[model samples]
Target chain A: MIRSIFIKETQLLLKDKGTYFWLFVLPILFIVMFSSIFGNAGTTTYTIRYFDADGTKESRQFMDTLAQIKGFELAADNEKSLADQIQAVRDGKQTSLLVIPQGYSQRLLGKGAAEVELHRDAAEDAAAAPVAAVLDSVTKQYQEHKLRVALKGTGQSQTGIDALLTAPIQVKDIKENVAKANPVTQIVPGYTVMFVFFIMITMIHNFLRDRDSGMVSRLKGTPLKAHQYLIGMWLPNMMVVLVQSTVLLTFGFIVYGLHLGDLFAVAAVIISLSICATGIGLMLSVLVNSVNTGVAIVQIIAMGGAIVGGLWFPYELLPKAVQWIGLFTPQYWAQRGMQDVMIRGAHLDGVWMTILILLAFGLAGLAVATASFNRFAAKAKN
Target chain B: MKHVLEVADVVKRYGSKTALDQVDVHVKEGSCFGLLGPNGAGKSTLMKLMTGILQADSGMIRAFGMDTRHQMSEIRQRVGYVPQEITLYEKLSAVQNLKFFGEMYGVNGAELKQRIAHVLEQVGLSDRANEAVETYSGGMKRRINLAAALLHQPQLIILDEPTVGIDPQSRNHIFEMIRGLKKEGLTLVYSTHYMEEVEALCDDIAIIDHGSVIAQGSLHEILEQHADQAVYVESDYITEPPQLSSIKRASARGRGWVLESEQPLHTLRDLSQLFAEAGARVHALELVKPSLDRVFLKLTGTALRD
Candidate 1:
């Protein structure tokens, strides 16, 4: 009986175009969109608009030095005066501007201070900070050149000047587990986990349709039992969630080259996550009174859970309070479990806690659904 | 005749309102038993109770010599119920829908496949079995709905308003299917408000009103027992109702007047002689045949639709 109902439901869902759009197409679109936007974040360039009041070779050389940096570009916009460019920054039209005063080249030749002014909007501090850092680094390099010339004048050897020019502290950066930690890692698994819960919407629709159409009452007259019907309806949705997850993750793998570490552990998380989602789906199917109400509840669970559970972004970037609350959702556990295997290179032993928590949620949902199923069946049209 | 179903003093209530009150009905084997009533007359409520979809507040229902409360599963295996609503997955094809229902009734394997083919042919939709139900016409959908209940071949089939809102062709097709089932010695409980349906298909019937069985017997018995005897008269000269000694009451009926009496033949004879003496132009003057419509009107004091 379970196999019969499972096959029937699978066939019905295959014919329903709406389920396909929700469970598969919508999530893949999100993955593709977000991955495209954030994939090249490390190499994105920021423009620093500047006016060189002194047209001498020294001022042009200063501009050339700043432009050589990888992510910062110098744009000479002479159409707006220095004052007007400053006003543009104040009006929030531009993030920042740079000015080289008239005596900059003379001051450098005369052994005096050469200063360049950087005017930026306070509200656009995040965008302006990087430009400010680059200017400061260029100033330090010029000071080093002056020091080298002064040391040579004092009769020191070139080797001593070079040793003195090195900074006292050296910051060496090391990257770990960065083989695949790109936007693809966040987007592919995030969207797959987020949209797997949408199976609840389809479950609610099928259950309520069965009740309202008198199918429940009609089936009650048959030899099929209540538990058989409940489990029969539930197994098909779980399988659908499994298929949806596989399609999305595979799309990420093929299109974005998302590295999947430990295939067995990833598959385990996928299986457990499917159980957790469809189990809650069963609970909601029996608890909700109408299809509209069921849809509302599912939206709250899927969308709200996605936001707090870090399915839209990395969990480390969320507010501390939200991160604490995220631990309570099944989505958080499922996503953490998948990332632990895919991003952290964790094996089954490392992710056993996640799997257990997810299964606990699924089993609890099944228990509630089993207890309330009689009331749900009783309300069917007879 | 052996009784296949027996319902004694079945009373069902929905909250404070009573839906069925002391309803008793018995169905003989191989006979078509019709439950006749207007809408909200408790015909569906009683049918649900018999199929074990609902439990009566206080009643004893036995099907195939098994008690409904304790042996409902056993009864469900032998009884087929076709609800008033067209309960089908419209997104699925007719063959798919039949396969699901056939398995639900515990028919499986090659037997289920054969039965699916048989029922599709029986409902006259064998050619369109692969088409989705949503694509079918209303009459075609109704045929498939009835066909779903016949896959398991239950001994007793209960149908609640199965022919409502159907085209003439589909209704005739269903009637023919029911007749064929009866010819094969299957008992059927058909519920409807149409009197002609009962007259044509049912051997025994129970007329229900306001949750009670006002009358129940063979089709001939109910009409003879409660239907009034009357003579209809139409004449140009006798405009007013004729004042006769034998007539009890008189009322207008179409272009004529129906005069109620204890002896309809005597009143017919009196009207004939009066028409002959006065030499009036009598158009229609005859003894009115007893009908369930008149029987329902006499018992409930309202039309079936009302």
Candidate 2:
């Protein structure tokens, strides 16, 4: 009986083109669009155009220092006129333009202040701000070097000058327990979990349609038990969700190069999430009175859960209250579990808690849904 | 004859509304028992209870000599039900629907396949067995619905208004199918508001109203007990109502007089004599036996469909 019902339900689902689109096409579209927009996270490099009118050693040394800074690729195109560089900046092709004055090195050596001109596009302020800050710090270091050289000339010892120039305390930055947070990891699993809920809408629709059409009463009239009928109703939906998740995850891996650590752990998370989603579908199927009401409720659940549970973006970026509320959604836990595996390279040991929580959600949903289904069957029969 | 189903003082209620009130019924084995009632007359409720889909509020229902509550699985295996509405997977083919329902009743493998083939042939939809039910016509769908019920080959078949919303030819085909089942000695409990269907197919009947069985007996017995014996006479001279002493009630019916009496033979003889004395020849004088519709009207004081 279970096999028969499952096959029938699966055939029905395959026949529904709308469900096919939502299950497969929508998730891939979300992944591809978001990946293209936010693909270059840590790999992005900003170009800085520099021109040196002063060919002195000091200016040459400053240019060398600027070239070694992280995430800034220096372009000292002396052949191109400074006017052309400025035009590039104005046209938004260049992020910023730097120019050294004619007497810069001589002024610095002779204890006279010198100024350098930096031109940037206002619209590129976000990218130009960091370049400007780096330039300021490099200039300050050069001034400090000049001061040290002046002090040495005044007969101060090298050690004393070095100690004075360096601060009494040294600070170092150490990153702790941080994973590689990138757009691919975030959006792939984010949309995967988000689209998993869409399967609930299909499940609820099939359930309500069968009930309203009197098929439920007919099935109950047979010798099949209630649990058998429940399994028959639930298993096919669960399988559809599992297939949807697997396909989306595979698409993410192939297209976006999504890194999944411990495939078994990821599979466990997806299985639990599918069960939870199927449970929600079951509960909603009986709770609502009509197909229109069921569709409305499912929409609220899928779209609302996606927004609140950080499927589109990280919940940590939201307000503390919203983040706390996100903890209440199954999507939050499922997305968190996927992030652990894909971003943190977590193993099975790491995601067991998330699996258990999702399982609890699924079990609770099944309990309430089963009770409601039984009540519905009884009422229908009467 | 052995009793296939028995209901004694069964009462079923839905909140404040009583759907079945002190309903008692007995279905003899190998006989077609027609449950006659108007809409909401407890026919469906009683059918559900007998099929073990529903439980009575305060009474016992036994089918196949077993309690419905305790032996539901056994009873379900022995009874087939065709609901008033189409209960099928519209997207699935007739054969697929039959196969699935057959599996639910523990029929599978070669047996299930053979049953599906047999039922599709029985319903005369063998050519359209692979077509989706949604693509089939209403009569074809109804045939598939009946085929689904017969998949398990249950001893008793309970149909709730099975022939509703179908063409006359299809209705007659359903009657032929029911007759075929009856020839096989399958006990049938058919409920419908169509009196002609009951009159054509049923051997025994129960007429219910307001959740109570107002009349029940063999077809002939119920007709004899409640139906009026009237002699309809048509004569050229009888333009107005006839005044006959032997007739208890005489009323003019279009170009004729319908005369009711305790002695129908004597009333007919007196009508013929009166027509001869009036210098008018009687063109037609025939005894009109009461139909089930008239019997239902006499018992329920309303039309069968009302």
Q: lDDT: which candidate is best?
A: 1
Clashing pairs in 2: none
Separately for all candidates shown, the number of backbone clashes (residues 3 or more apart, or on different chains) is: 0, 0
Instruction: List candidate 2 stretches off by more than 4 Å.
Output: A44-128, A141-180, B234-239, B250-257, B277-284
lDDT of 2 by residue, B168-254 (tens): 767777888899999999999999998888888899999989899988899998988888898888877767667777677776767
Pull out the clashing pairs in model 1: none
lDDT of 2 at A124: 87
Writing each residue's lDDT as its tens digit, candidate 2 over A184-209 gives 88898999898888877887788777
True-vs-predicted CA distance for residue A115, candidate 2, Å: 5.0
Residue A171 in model 2: shift from native, Å?
A: 6.2
Pick the TM-score winner.
1
CA lDDT scores, all candidates in order? 0.92, 0.86
> Residues B168-246, candidate 1, lDDT per residue (tens digit)?
9999989999999999999999999998898899999999999999999998899889887999998897878999999
**Residue A331, candidate 2: C-alpha displacement in angstroms:** 1.9
